[model samples]
Target chain A: MSVRFWRVRALAMLLALFVGGCTAPPLLTAVLGPPLKPLPVAGRLRRPVYKPYHEETMTYNLVPPPKADWHAKLKALPLTAAGGTDWVKALNENLIKPKPGLDAKAEDEPVMDLDVVLTPKDAPDFKVTYPHKPHTQILSCDNCHTGIFQMQAGADPITMEKIFAGEYCGRCHGPVAFDPASACPRCHTAMPQ
Target chain B: MRQAALWLALLVLATLLPAAQVSAEQGDIVFTRSSKEEGADYPPATFPHYVHRMQFKCYVCHDAIFKMKAGADKVSMDAIDKGKFCGTCHNATIAFGPTFESCQRCHK
Candidate 1:
C-alpha cells in the first residue's frame, strides 16, 4: 500500500480513539489542509473561522400591567374616574414614573400571563383575552421589552405618539411583526382627537 | 523500468486526485425531508454529517458503528453490545454506554 495511505489511516485512527474505538476513513482526511498549523496547546478546540450572528423572530407572552392601568384607557373614562388627571399628568405618573415589569423572563423563552384590561377607548371595560399561552409557545420575551419600556408591570406607556413612532406596540404591529407603511388610522383610530 | 514508472504515476494520481477532490469540496450537508412521515412526523434528527463535522472532530462520532460509506455504517443494538454505535461513548459520558436502556433509546 502507499505510504500516504498508511499515514492518513494512522492519523484517522488516532482521532477515532478520542470518541470511541471507531476508525475514520483515510479518504476523509484533508489532502493539503492549509499548512500544518500546530493545534493550540490549551485551546485546541478553537475554530479557525468566525461566524456571524443570525437574526430570528423572538416571542414573549404579554400581560396587561396589573398594579397600574393604561392612563390613556383610564383617562378616557371620565375626568373624575381617571383620577381627574390630565393626559400629561397621567403619563408622568402612571406610564413614565412607575415602569412595567416582565414578571418573568428567560433565554429563548416566552413569558405567559392572563390579561385583564379596563380600557375606556371606544369599547367597554373587558379583559383582552391576550393569547399569552399560545404566544409563549412561539415567541421570545426579548422581542417585546425595549429600553423605552422597563421589564416590569407598567413601564411602557402604550401611548399613541410612541406607538406610531414605532415604539411600544408599534415595534411589532408595524415593522418588527407587521408592515407599518399603511395609513396612520390603523393604530390611531381609537385615540381621542 | 516502464512498469515501475507506470506504478509511480498511478501512486501520484491517487495522491493528486484527493487534493483535487479536496479543492472541489464545498463541505456542507443539506437536509430536506419530503416524506409525510419525516421531520414533523419523525424526529429522528436527520443527522447532518457536514454540520456535525463543522463543530466537532471526526472522532466525536466515527465510532465502530459508522463507516466511511453511507450504508456501511452498521448501527444496531446488537453491535452496540460490543461497545459499538452510540453506546461507545454513551457508556462513558453520554449515558450507560449501551445498555438495555440504550437499545430502546435508539431503536424506538
Candidate 2:
C-alpha cells in the first residue's frame, strides 16, 4: 500500500477510537430513541425489586427537635419605649453583666454605648440610629471598628446602595446577622417631622 | 512541522480544559447524618462544604480528619468535645466551639 493510504487509514482508526470512547450510552440514547425495554419477567423473583429509600418519608424525627421559632431568635432585642432614659443606657442596664474573670476596674467600667445618627442628604426622611452597644456584646470592637467602619466618625462613606450590595454592615447583617430588610425599624428609628 | 506542533498543542489544551473547569467549581455538600442515626437530639447538621473549600484545599479534611467516603466518619458530641473530628477546628480560638449556645448554628 502507498504511504499516503497507510497514513489515512491510521488517522481514520484514531478518529473512530476517539469518537467511540467519547460517546456515552446516555448521550447516544438521547440522540436516538429510548433504549429497548428489559425482558418481562414471567413469575415473581425470589428477592423483591429494589426501591430507593425515600429520605423525606423514611427518616426518624429529631429526638428533641428544632424549635419552630429558631429563625425568630436571630432578631435583635426589642427597642425600649421612646419616652425613657437614653435607649442605649436602658439596654445596657438590662443586659450587661460583669465578666467573672475580669479585674475589679475592668468589671466596674461600664459597657461603652456610642450611639451615632446616620443621616444621608438624599434620604431626609429616614435616619439610621446605629447603636454600637448591642453589637459590642456579641462581637469584639475590632470586628467592625477598623475592618468595616473607621474609628473616627463619618470616615466611611456608608450608603444604602453599598449596604444592599453586601458591603460594610451588609457582610454579616444580611446572611449571618439580622435580616436587614425585615428589621428596618430596628435601625431606622428617627421619626420624620 | 509547525502545523503538526500546533495540532499537538491544541489536542493537549482540549484534554485539560474540562478537568480545570470541574475542579474550579465546587458545589455545597450538605450532610444529613442525623436523619440516619437513631436518637439524634437536634436536626441534621447542614455542613456548607463550599464555605470551607474557599479557605482550604480538599485534602485538608478528606482522607485525614474524615474519610473520602460519605457516612464513613462516626462523628459524635463526645468525640467532638475531646477534639477529635469537628472539635479540631471548633476549639473556640479557631472557630466557635461545639457548645450549647452555638448548637443552632449547625444543628438547624
Candidate 3:
C-alpha cells in the first residue's frame, strides 16, 4: 500500500477510538452507523489496566518536625490512671496554664467559689455537685447562668437524659471537656448510701 | 509643577487614610450619667471597648444596640436589670448582669 493509504488508515483508527470513547452518540452513529457490541478479548490478548503515573505519595514537609526531646515536657505533666491528660490535676499542679479569656492583655476574671448541689427529681440518688470555681476559672458567669442554666436553684431541670442530648453541662463537657458518658462519678459526687 | 502638586496630594491622602481607619479604635468609655450629679455609692461604669472588640464585631453593638454618639442613650441600673441598653448582653443570660456582687466588674 502507498504511504498516503497507510496514513488514512491510522487516522481512521484514531478517530474510531476517540468516537467509541466519547459520549457523542449522534456523531458516532452518523459516521460509523449504529454502535456494535464489544467483542471479548481472550486471556493472552487482554492488557493489564493501570494508572500511568504511579509515583510514591508525597510527604507533607511544610510543617517542621518536632525536636528530639519533643513530648518530654508533655509526658512529665500529670496523667490520669487511664493514661489520658488530667486537665484539672495539671491545672492544680501548675503543669499547664490556660488563659480565661482569648485576649492575653485582658484582666483575669473572678471565679465564683459557690458550689451548686443539684438533686434531679428523677434520679434523687445521684446528686450532682456543680462547682463554679473550675467553670468560672475559664468561663464568665453569663456563659452558663441564665443562658444554659438558671441562677435560682430548682429553676432549671437538669437530667442525665438532657445532658447526654448536648444540653446544659453537656455543651462543653461532651464536646470540649471530658465525655460525661464515661466519667459519671466525676460529676455525680454524692452517691446514695 | 502640576504633577508634583498631584503627588503631594496623594501623599497627604495616604497619611490621612490610616488615621481615619484607626479612629474606630476608641478608648474605654466611662459612663458618668448615673454617678456624675450625686455622690453615688458606686463609681462610674467603665466599658472596656478593647475587651468587647476582641470578642465581637463593630456592628454587633453599634447603631442597633448603642448609638455611636457619647451619652446619646440613657443607661441606668434599673434599665440594665430589666434587660435594656447594657442589659441586653449583661442580663446574666448573655453576660454577667450588673448585679450588686458584680458591681466592680463594670464599675472598675
In model 2, which runs have C-alpha deviations exceeding 4 angstroms? A1-110, A191-193, B1-108
Q: What TM-score does each model's chain B reach against the true chain B?
A: 0.35, 0.64, 0.68
Model 3, total clashes: 0
Q: TM-score (chain B) for model 1?
A: 0.35
Per-residue lDDT of model 1, residues B23-45, tens digit only: 11112222232334212232221
TM-score of 3: 0.39
In the predicted model 2, the residue pairs found to clash are: none
Listed per candidate, the RMSD to the true structure in angstroms reads: 27.1, 19.1, 29.2
Instruction: Quantify all predictions' global Cα lDDT against the true fold.
Output: 0.36, 0.52, 0.57
Give the distance in Å from residue A39's predicted Cα in candidate 3 to where it truly belongs.
Answer: 41
DockQ each candidate and list the results. Answer: 0.01, 0.05, 0.01
Colliding residue pairs in candidate 3: none
* Model 2 per-residue lDDT at B101: 45
lDDT of 1 by residue, A58-117 (tens): 111122113222323433422322122232333324432221221223222434765434
Which whole-number lDDT from 0 to 100 does residue A98 have in model 2? 24
